[model samples]
Target: MSPILLTEDLTMTYHVGKVDVHALRGVNLSVAPGEFVSIMGPSGCGKSTLLHILGGLLKPTSGRVIVDGEDLAAVGDAQRTDIRRRKIGFVFQRFNLFPTLTADGNLRLAEHIHGNHRSKAELAELRREVLGLLGLEKKLHHKPLELSGGEQQRVAIARAVINRPAIILADEPTGNLDSENSEIVLDMLVRLNSQFRQTIVMITHNPEAAAIAERIVEMRDGRIIRESQPDRGAKRG
Candidate 1:
């Protein structure tokens, strides 16, 4: 099987005034269909910028992004969005849930935006399954502010995975949570990855968070500096 995502010499440069912000430089990466990878770096190292590129939110200045065999740069904005909706799921640190909508509503809205329109019944089933899997079944009717931070983040994860997307891109997913809540979310994420075999690429500053992934790629000055596997002994330098 082909990798779900491939990037060769990926580069993103922004010309600000007389200076250039080289966000990414020659980042060659391949994420397999059912793998979890983490990207870690200091601020200004371009980790978030790289996530935007992978998620099709930003175009690389000069590089090839072949996601599920569709080259993003080759397609127009509409097509890139179509592919993003169909193949990708994103979870952010802030949860980014609809404050006014219930958990159930958020997932359904995501379904409506994504591809291969399932029937209303099917969509409902998908929502139910996501809620059940994420342990949010009891809180499906709760609004964002009504739920605890951990619960809200779980709902966000459910919303992301409701479509059963080919890949899940998480950006600083545990950044805002307490230690206990962070562990809970991380455990849930690992469970989901194992159960659904969802390709996951997470950007995080926490070494402990990155250690949960199978492979960790460190970046510096907009370039990949090292790639390593993490054992229990792993710690940031």
Candidate 2:
């Protein structure tokens, strides 16, 4: 099977005054469908920049990004936005939920924006399943401000998966929570991946967090330096 996400010699550069800051240098990555991969790096290592480029939020300065068959680097702004909406779901350190919308409402808004062909009843069932898997079934009526940090992040995760996008891009998903809540959120992510075969590419600074993935990729100074699999007992064929 072809890789759902692919990057070939991906590079990004920023001009600061007279200096050229290299954010990425010749990054080549491939993620199989239904696989979970984690990226780890120190600050300014270019992991975040790679994620942004993969998500189509930033155009690469050179090379190609092929997500679910579409070349993001070659697309125009509108086409890139469309592909992002159709194939990618993003989770960040900050829970970017709507302040005024309840948990369910936020999910519904995402569903509306994606505008899929799922029937109303099917959509509702999917939403309920995603929320239930994330342990947000009871918190659906709560708004962002009313929920705990973990609860809000769970809601964000649910919103991201409600439409069953081809891939999820998570950047430091547990960065804001305490240890207990971070564990809870990570467990929920594991459950989602195992049950739904959701493909995920997560960028994290925590080694423990990166260990949960099927494969761990380490980066430094704008390049991938190492790759390994965590000793989490059994591998998921």
Candidate 3:
């Protein structure tokens, strides 16, 4: 089977004022279905840029991003957006939840945006299952402000996975949480990967967070420096 996500000679350059800022320099990566991988790097190392490119949020300057067998660089904006909505899910450092909507409302919005043809009953069932999986079944009526940071992020994760996208791109998902909350979120992510077989590519600076993934990829100066399999038995943050 083809990799769920693949990047070949992925290069991105930004023209800021008079300078050319090179964010990615020929990044080649492949993540098989159900695999969990983390990209670790210092700030300005282009990890975030790579994540965005993989998610179809940004088009790389020169290279190919094949997501679930579709070439992102070859599609027009509308087609790209369609592919992203159907095939990719994203969780960012900031919990981009709607402040006014309840947790359930937020998740329902995602389902609606996904444009699934399920009946109302089926959609409701899916929502229940996802909320239960994320331990948010009882928080359905709570708004973002009413939930703790961890709970809010869990809701965000639930929203991301509600449509069962082929791939998930997480960028510093634990960056804003406290240590205790971070562990909860990370454990939840591990469960999603292990039990649900969700293919994930997460960008993080925390080694402990990286340790939870099946593989860790280190990047420096816009290039992959190394890759290794993490010891699953080791403690993770």
Candidate 4:
């Protein structure tokens, strides 16, 4: 099968006063359908830039980004937004849950924003299934403050996947959780990929977190320096 995501010679440059800062320099990357890949890099190394470009949040200065066969670089703003909404789900380091919204309410809000046309019954069933998969069924009516950090992050993940997007772009998904909670969140991500064959590209600095991926990509100075399969047998963090 063709790759679900592909980038060729991706580059992004920002003009900072008198100098041009390059965030990505000729980065070439690809992620297979339903494959889980992790990107590891130091600060200011362009991992976030690459992820943003892949998710259609930013256009590369000069390169090609093809997501599920749609060329992001060639699309207009509205089209890019449409593609992102329909094909990509994003999980950030911050949970970003609304404090006043219950877990179920947060998820339904996402569905509403995504313009899902499913009937109420179908939508409710999907919401319950996603929450159950993420182990948040019992906390459905609880607001963000009522849940623990891990539970809130799980709710964020649930909101991202509720629409069953083609790919999930996770930026330091476990960064804010304690080690115990980090392990739980990582395991849930693995289970999601294993059970539904979800395509995932995660950006992380932690080796233990990166190991959950089938492949690990290392980057520095705005370019990918290496790629290898992680040793899953290593001791957990």
lDDT of each: 0.88, 0.91, 0.91, 0.91
**Which is better, 2 or 4, measured by TM-score?**
2
Error of 2 at 118 (Å): 1.6
1-237 per-residue lDDT for model 2 (tens digits): 999999999999988999999999999999999999999999999999999999999999999999999999998999999999998899999999999999989998999999899898998889878877887778889899999999999999988899998789999999999999998988877877889888999998898888889999999999999999898764333
Q: lDDT, candidate 1, residue 131? A: 75
Predicted candidate 3 versus true structure: per-residue lDDT over 67-170, tens digit per residue: 98899988998999999999888998999999999998998899989999888888777777777778998898999999999999999999999987878889
The parts of candidate 1 lying over 4 Å away from their true place are 232-237
- Runs of candidate 4 exceeding 4 Å displacement: 234-237
Worst 10 residues of 2 by lDDT: 228-237
In model 2, residue pairs whose N, Cα or C atoms come closer than 3 Å (at least 3 residues apart or on different chains), thus clashing, are: none
State in Å the error of residue 199, model 3.
0.3
User: Each prediction's Cα RMSD?
Assistant: 2.8, 1.5, 1.6, 1.9
Which ranges in model 2 have alpha carbons more than 4 Å from their true place? 234-237
